[model samples]
Target: MSKPRKGILIILSFFAIYVIWGSTYLMNKIVVTEVAPFLLAAIRFLSAGTLIMVIAKILKFSLKITKAQFINCVIAGFLFLFYGNGIFVWALKYVDSGFAALIVATQPLFVIILMRILQGKKIQSKSLMGVGLGLVGMYLLISQDTLVLSEESSIGIAVIFSCVLGISFASIFVSRANLPSHFFVTTGYQMLTAGTLLLIGSLVLDETWTSPLEWSGKAQLAMILLIVFGSIVAFTAFNFLLKEVSTEKVATSAYVNPVIALLLGWYVLNETISVQSLIAGAVLLTGVYFINSKKKIVIFSRFKKN
Candidate 1:
């Protein structure tokens, strides 16, 4: 590929993942207004997975993996899409989409702590500082009266934050596992597995197929957008860009995501944004930047002069 063309493609890919993934919070909120949360998520992933599988076959990509790899995919699928994503959808029942995104944006904090606890990883000074700042930010975000959750929003925020553990552990697990050579193959199978399980769960919950008269056109369109743009296009772009760009650069999506969610929620849904929440969100994103960045954070250094 030519240099300029490659640059354009890279930019396009980044935009797809960043903007589309961010906007999905609002789209998901819209859909869940009509369809059952887990069922909507199931359909979204199932459709995306089937589409990607067809495209992979048409392009003659390898669709084969070992039994162990398939099992790994199943585990990751349940952790990531089934639990993490499903819980987020359920949380939207009581919270604003933007608020949920803000809470979910603390995923790195949870990941860092989990690594320390489970793997005996040493926490660096910079990480400690970032964690401190992130905690303060989270406190500010949740505390309506500046020091405590005002009863109404506590459970909703807690529910959203709980998914962070699922996603963080899943990410760590997948990082250590020897998965398929093809990104699409792994993601497709993972999505298919998650979708299948979610569908079964929905069935067990006695969720029947939502009729056209029951679900609005807006809800239908939102699901379609989530399946195509959010799941398929954004994920393909994300995997591609991870190979193209620096990891820290790709990690910027973590910061931009909540911002996009906040903006879209305010603009499209007319969701109220508190000044305290906005300030807290800014601090939270700054902490996330510090966590991802390599720029030296010199809290203090102890050196013995010889």
Candidate 2:
């Protein structure tokens, strides 16, 4: 690809992951109101995963995987999709989407700690400062006097933190794991396996599986957006960036997403953003910037989409 075309594609991919992925918090919040969370997640992933597989085949990409690769994909899928995404959606029933997004933005902070524990990585001074600010930001965000911390809301907050941890671990795992070389193939397998497991989990929990035909028009539209743009488009762009740009540059999405989510949630859903939340967000994002300041992007050979 020429430099000009590559630059344009990079900008577009960043938009997909930044704006589109950010909007998903609001979309999922809307859909989860009527659809059971696990069921909704299963449907979204299953549909996106299937569509991705068909697209990969049509593009003549090999779909074959080794046994070890398949197992790794399953583990990744479980960590990333089933536990990380699925439970996060479930938490939407109790938490505002904007609030959840703010908390989830602390993922980089979690990643640093997890890397230290699991990989025996040393904490840099900059990272330690980031962690400190992140903790203070979190305390301010969650301990708002204006906010009512109901038991359900407290549980939702806890669950969202766990999801962040799961996603953080998955990121580290994927960086080192052996998997399909093609992003499309790897994503398809991960989503498919995760979606299947989510389905089984939903059934086991005896959640009412409502048909789309019975859902509100708004809910249906939200679900469609979640499946297509959120899961397929944004995620594909993310993987694409991982190969094309530095991960630190891609990590900028962490700062952008919460801002987008907060604005959209407030504008569309009338979700209140307290002054404390805003202050916390500023502090939190600053910490994330600090943590990412010195990292380099690990780029790979660029691949063609078609």
Candidate 3:
């Protein structure tokens, strides 16, 4: 690809991950209200994956993958979509969307820590400062009277934290994993793999599955957005960026998603935005900035292909 074209793709991908993904908190929160978490996730991923596969085939992108590549895709699917997203959505039952986003904002911290541990990469001074600030922000967010007063809220927060760690690890793994060269193909397979697992989970848990025709109009619309924009567009951008840039650079989306989720939650859902929450978000985003400040949008000359 040409330099200008690559730059445009990078910017567009960032916008998808940063802005589009932020809105998904509200989408998932809305859908999960009436749908069981695993069921909801399964539907979204299955639909999106099928759509992506159809599009890829029409565009003549090869769908074939070796056994090792398929296995890696399944692993990525499990870590990222099944546990990271499905469990996170389950937490939404007990936690507010905006608050959940704020809590998950600690993802960049997790990513950097994993890099240091797994790769023995030295942490920069700025990143160390970022980690300190992120911890402070996290403490403030979780120590709120609302969270402390409710046992369910505490469990939800802990679950979301675990999801963030899994997602963080997935980000690092995707950077090195061999998969289909085309982002669409890779994303489709992973989504399908995760969707299948989530379906089985939903059945195993005996979660009631409602048909789409019976869903409310608003829920239907939210599901559509979640399937198309959230799952397809934003997730494809996420996969693309993991290969194109540094994981820390891609993790910068954490800095923006909470702010967007907060505003949308406050405006649309009328979710309370506590003053402490605002302060925490500010501190957390600043920490993210410090962690990612030195990282640039450096695209790899050749994407890793199976």
Best by lDDT: 3
Ranking by lDDT: 3, 2, 1
Query: Could you estimate the TM-score for every candidate?
Result: 0.76, 0.79, 0.86
Ranking by TM-score: 3, 2, 1
* lDDT accuracy of residue 101 in candidate 3: 59
Give me the overall lDDT of model 3: 0.84
Q: 1 or 2, which is superior by lDDT?
A: 2
| Candidate 3: regions farther than 4 A off | 91-103, 135-145, 149-160, 270-282, 295-306
Candidate 2 root-mean-square deviation in Å: 4.8
Worst 10 residues of 3 by lDDT: 296-305
Give per-residue CA lDDT, model 1, range 1-306, as digits (tens). Answer: 698997897889878866898899789878877788778889989999999999999999999999999999899889878988886676666776546655665666676667668665566777666656666676676565433333566787777777777777776566556667777777798889999999998888788678645788898788889988999888777655544543334445655676577779888978788998799778867766666555653211211112
lDDT by residue (tens digit), candidate 3, 1-306: 898998899889999998899999889878878999899999999999999999999999999999999999999999999999888877877887647756776787788789879876666777677767876776676567453224578888888989999999999899889899898899999999999999999999899989999989999999999999999999999999898877877877877676677779889978798999899888878876776574532221223434
lDDT of 2 by residue, 91-148 (tens): 8778766577567767766766666687656667776676567666766665664444
Best by TM-score: 3
lDDT of 2: 0.78
Task: List candidate 2 segments past 4 Å from native.
Answer: 1-14, 90-105, 134-161, 241-256, 270-281, 294-306
